[model samples]
Target: MDKVLEGLKYAAAGAGGLFAYLFGAWDALIIALVIFVVADYITGIAKAATQGKLSSAVGFKGLLKKVMIFVLVMVGTVVDKAIPAANHAIRSAVIMFYIANEGLSILENAGELGLPLPKTLKSALEKMKDEKPEDVPAEEQE
Candidate 1:
């Protein structure tokens, strides 16, 4: 039992270190992104189940896409490091875009469940649709 506990501790430490290395320090933005991602996934499942469209394949694909989002964020972090002048700018932009995108998806899920959504929130997300990482300016990259 002691050996198993020690192994678990080591595994957790390794996972945490990898998360920090890839995502940088966990900030408010990151926390929000994580929450949004989870909420979106749960809502997606609910939506699919209600519509009788649930499939293991689709769920697995959604999981893969979620993992890919983190991978893309890691890529942005690496790119930011390559450009010494930029401090996490690419990563921040990438995360921000996903946050908004996931938030919109959640709202869509809510709407599917017959919940009313605010127009302003929808419009804000729509406006930010074009403000993705690639669309951000060099000056803002700092």
Candidate 2:
């Protein structure tokens, strides 16, 4: 009985360790961001379909851009590991950048569905979008 209990505990701990190794906080965040991005894209497409605004080409381009975001995150992970000292700074920034983008996109999705959004957040999003590319820091601008 004691041996069995120890074995079960070890197995559970090993599984948790695996999950933590594969899905660190930043990785988990990016996964959530990707889910939001996909949901937003689907809702936007559905809205377009209902409103006669469908465009396969534009949707494909948007998907490509989303793919680029993942590529950037992967690159950030590599940089993070390469540095081996900064304590996930690159990954954290990458996750934050994508989180902000996905959050804004989800807000747009909600708006398309006629859901109300906070005025301040909406205005801030507009301001962020309106800022010149050269003006915003590259990391934050993403």
Candidate 3:
């Protein structure tokens, strides 16, 4: 039991390290992206179920796309690392783009389910899709 517990702890540590490396820092940007991705997926499933249009193939395809989002993030992080002067520029942009996309998708799914959305939030989400890191001033970089 002692050996098993020790092995589990090591495994958890390894997983945590790998997650940090792949996803970069766990800042608000990454956390929001993760939440948006998950909520989008759940809402998508709910939307399909409500409309009676659920299909295994479609779900699989959606899952593949979600996985690809992370792959892009990883690639962006790698590119940033390769360019010493780049301070997470690529990764931040990639994450922002996906976060907006996912948020929009979730809103769409909610709409399909007859949920009324706040106009301000709807507009904000629409704008987010086209946002770029450079568009914001350096003072608000944090």
Candidate 4:
């Protein structure tokens, strides 16, 4: 039992290290993205269930898309590493873009579920959703 417990601890640390390496630091932006991703997924299911349109295939596809968001983040990290001057700019942009995107989706799901949303919040998210990271000037990004 002692040996097994020690092995488990090593495995957990290895997994965590890999995750951090792949996703960069586990900062507030990452935390927000995680929360928004999970909330959006849950709200999506609720919205679909309420509309009687819930399907396993669609749900699986949604899961795939969510996974892809992280995959893109990994790609961004790779790019940042390649361009040392970037200083995690690419990864940060990817995370921020997805955070905005997922937040908007969550709001939409809430609306579908007959939940009232603040107009200002919705408009702000919409604006963020429309702004592509590449379109932002490099100076503004810094």
Q: For candidate 4, write residues 111-134 as lDDT tens digits.
A: 878889889987877676666567
Whose lDDT is higher: candidate 3's or candidate 4's?
A: 4
> lDDT value for candidate 4?
0.87
* Stronger candidate by lDDT (1 vs 4): 4
Q: Residue 24 error for model 4, in Å? A: 0.5
> How high is the lDDT of residue 130 in model 4?
60
All candidates' lDDT scores? Answer: 0.84, 0.70, 0.84, 0.87
Number of the predicted model whose lDDT against the real structure is largest? 4
**Model 4 regions lying over 4 Å from their true place:** 130-142
What are the per-residue Cα lDDT tens digits for candidate 2 across 1-142?
9999999999999997765554354356767777867876787788778778899997897788777777777677677878989678877776666666666777876787788988898666555444334665755432
What are the clashing pairs of model 2? none
lDDT of 3 at 25: 77
**Model 2 compared with the native: what TM-score?**
0.64
Error of 2 at 25 (Å): 7.3
Candidate 1 TM-score to native: 0.80
TM-score, cand. 3 vs. native = 0.85
Better of 2 and 4 by TM-score: 4
User: By descending lDDT, how would the candidates be arranged?
Assistant: 4, 3, 1, 2
**Of models 1 and 3, which has the larger TM-score?**
3
TM-score of each model, in listed order = 0.80, 0.64, 0.85, 0.86
Best by TM-score: 4
